[model samples]
Target chain A: MKKILLLAGTALALAAGTMTASAQEKLKACWVYVGPIGDFGYSYQHDQGRLQVEKELGDKVETAYLENVSEGPDAERAIERFAREGCKIVFTTSFGFMDPTIKVAKKYPDVKFEHATGFKKADNVAIYNARFYEGRYVIGQIAAKESKAGLAGYIVSFPIPEVVMGINAFMLGAQSVNPDFKVKIVWVNTWFDPGKEADAAKALFDQGADIIVQHTDSTAPLQIAEERGLKGFGQSSDMIKFAPKAQMTSIVDDWGPYYVKRVQAMLDGTWSSTDTWEGMKEGAVVLPPFANMSDETKKLAEETYAKIKSGEFHPFTGPIFDQAGAEKYPAGAVVPDGDLLGMLWYVKGVDDKLPQ
Target chain B: MLEAIILTVITAATPLLLAAIGELVVERSGVLNLGVEGMMVMGAVAGFAITVSTGSPLLGIVAGLVAGLAVSLIFGFVTLTLVANQVASGLALTLFGLGLSGLLGEGFVGTPGIKLPSLSIPGLTDIPYVGRILFGQDILVYVSFALVLAVSWFLFRTRGGLVLRAVGDNHVSAHALGYKVIRVRYLAVMFGGACAGLGGAYLSIAYTPLWVENMTAGRGWIALALVVFSSWLPSRLVIGAYLFGAVTILQLHAQPLGLGVPSQFLSMLPYLATVVVLVAISGNRRATRFNTPACLGAPFVPDR
Candidate 1:
């Protein structure tokens, strides 16, 4: 009996040792998405980033993802589950996941958490975002040059600083070309709802706004533009296929490079909590090839893109005035990044009032 | 501008009308299936997939209707045949349908869909404001109106409709009277599934012409509420759907008008209207009870 017990103990020890050795062989990185990857918009682009991580670091890492995770108690549970599952890194991709990410990070201090488009962070939780407003400025210029009515319809999702910043940058760009250019803004208050987006597009078009700009993540508005023989810009992914004749250009979110770099940091034992806000210069926010626009307009858009990329132009340059005609920034003084990140007030020339 | 607003309103209202009319029938037969959203989403994915593969929106519509009916059979089997709890079974059906549709629609995501062409009558469709409103709609819009009228006529004017309602009101009594309660419910549930599917297909093939997961986006739940809001009456269902759709669209228009009202408040108008209307309707206890199915959400088990 004593001899048999010794043999069994030896076997169990060997099995446990092999499990630890295998666990050390590769790092596990996980992601929590707010919307389904099939959205082909915001969530789709983020999943592309995850796929890139897997492709670039094939043997060194194992990746997992939970799509369509709602941003509330559900997000916290998802993040906690990944942490408990021995994930070396967790990426929560939504602004609404900010507090939840922070909450989970506290419980799992060793797990590195990366959150997108959120402000709050902890010692173990890092925050990162893309300067989507940069591309919005370029689209704004295109809208100004292309719009025959000098009026553009803007379809927006929420009243977050991110969306508000995009609206301001667009207004600034439009005003640069046509000083009196106007935009009619409609807030549908959702990140994605194709039907509502379509309805908003129709409402804007009916109100005499010939050009459409959407901050929401769907191709529905662009499809509406194609149906009406009008033009608009695409969001998140290149939606040219959905609206071949209507898409002037698209603001594509490319998070693959940054994702690869961070995962590499984890493997190299150099991972730390850091805030990152990358833009066109880093290839984080890109605009696809211009189409359905005049050469002159395309050239103008390209120039704006190059300037923003080279840091030669800032969309929020001063001499800026709020909608109430109050000067927010003096001439020759650019709006600081801090102000832009938390911007709530609308720039002058925006047709609608900001929802407080 | 008026014509344009009216056109947008019609598109918005059509899907809700289609889904609600079907649920109205299901509830009238004493079965409250909360799986309308699931069935609708399944229809959307199936219709979009078929349309993409065949390059024919007509076939896509048919596929959606068939897919919806097919999914409803699962519900019918569990609740009617297996004698499972109807509420629990219906909710499970929704979750299952959503997950299954996502898996099925994996390849079709990000692909563009062919639009269902609207009916265009040369001389008749171009008449100033009213012409386009009445004659320029897609085939589904007309179909929705006709379905409502037909359902109204069937429920109020046909012997079959009376029997179905009797089954819903009191299954024991219905069975005692030699009516096949379980069989009547199966047919009613299948019809509901098909209509919900058609509504979902309209979304993918016509309204937005794309398929995304959860694309129905709680429209199914709205349809369920609309059934109650309409007091299970077909004509009132139409009014309730249009009212909901109109408020949804008009609120978007109202946003840019700078009325000093917050956009959030405008967004809330539709839900608020639903609650107000519901309260007003429920105040009339006689009317509410008269239309509500007595055996709704109750499972039936036949005696040997």
Candidate 2:
């Protein structure tokens, strides 16, 4: 009887310990945004992903976010605060947050860090970016089919590889429809400025562009296009409400599934650092229902989108030429991911000089 | 293309001209309020919010002006009444304004705005090159020009203007002469705030016709630089503002116009031009001595 009582006590103590451990397994997640959540653009979309994590995990995970956190030193502090606050996983959502995330990850090696639209990675830091160029290519097809002047104007923030890839993909998609299609680029060197973006749009409109494509985060370009009865594509989030008549389609960023999956991995103790670049196939970049287009154009856009998803159509398929008419890619060959990731030159039909 | 470019240049220049002209008067009265950026952003948010709610750009402009004035009064009380350091106070004002505007403008983001219509002068507006510029501008454009002319005439010609300038040139002497130095400074600061507010309203209503955080994009700083670049002269302020505007607009067209230089260099045109012009203007010591307010950025204490 004495032996049996001792064994029962040991079993009870072990079960109690297991229960306490499970209770402490509740995970804390944090996100750092580069702009105010009300931007209704880039930051807004990222915030939605944070919400998705909460919804998916319910009581198992708690999430928080710090908005309008500028890049550089400020970002490092914000990330560190999350780590110090007992957050197990932190996601820094902006390309500029790359180094800051890495720096903070080094100090808090146990904290898992996920950065978006960045290339750098460490043991504790995982980089993820959506193939936004894929969405740009789809929109470019729609713009080409519907453009009255066969001229599209692109308003970009910087000449980074990501932005350059979007421009090249857009032009390539347009060229597939109209071989003589041309694109004029105006670099604003800012991510969000409604006034400047609007001005750029008007300037491009005055220069005879009927379709405007923007890599910057603002509804101003599309709104300006709506005001002038022109068409454009939205960036970061769906902006159809802001420009119902003008938005042909928007490159809606769906970071929800990815965020939920990452949190799940962390919870299961199977988290590992890796780089993820998912496009339409992985559902990172989604397109809204086609609008401001004819039935035929919409059908064609759908078909092209499916082809991209199925790996049948690639935007950077060779024979590609640089702006200077030099062949960069040979015929019947698709550009490799390594080369596309570091693209800096504009395609042949782009009239702007690549700023070194 | 030339017509379009000119139109864009005008739109860009008007806000800078308005803000600079206001700061010019404030400096002429012997006070340096570095809160132009702060006040302008306040105007932007207040203007955008009122316009979005009321659906009237006119009321929005008024709210912007009043909002800017309200913010400037805080600076006025701090620097003029509390005798705080002008430079530090102004910097604090900018930080405050940016933060406050971001908070206030949270709800106004992404909302479509009503564009203030341009003034159509019938037949005169139809004339090709010079017509749209001189006759077909918006009401605020004319207001900006009128303010410049009015300020120029007021500063150089009127007795009141002389008293104001006297206060700026030498506050102690002006106080000895019973010129009400603090009162004059207060009015000058308020006027500067109102002008900056108008410039901000012009940005949200007429410039972009929409609201976004940090939409001023350092235009207020550029305006401040223009005041110094123009040697505090209202007429020169116009030249500097337009030149800056022209450079900004032309940079966008450089590549299309077949200029083979990199876009980054083109992007730096306005700022680089400002530095070059400032250096050239500073080289002439006589001009600087003649125009810079003797009491600029200096604290004044009136002894009863």
Model 2 over residues A1-356: C-alpha lDDT tens digits?
01111111231121111001123457988888888776778888887888888777957987767776777776777778789978899999999999989888999999999999888999999989888889988888888899989998889998889999999999888988888888878888888877678778877888888999999998888988998899999998888878889999999899999999999999899999998988999898999989989998999899999999988888788999987899989988899888888998888888777777
Lowest lDDT 10-residue stretch of candidate 1 chain B? B94-103
Best by lDDT: 1
lDDT of 1 by residue, B1-304 (tens): 8788888999999999999999999999999899999999999999999999999999999999999999999999998999888887888778777867887898999999999998899999999889999999999999999999999999999999999999999999999989999999999999999999999999999999998888898899999999999999999999899999999999999988889889999999999999999999899999899989999988888776
lDDT of each: 0.90, 0.86
Q: After TM-score superposition, what is the CA distance of residue A117 in candidate 1 from its true location, in Å?
A: 1.2
Worst 10 residues of 1 chain A by lDDT: A12-21
Which residue pairs show backbone clashes in model 1?
Answer: none
Chain A only TM-scores, each candidate in turn:
0.93, 0.91
Report, to 2 decimal places, the DockQ of model 1. Answer: 0.52
What is the Cα-based lDDT of residue B95 in candidate 1? 75
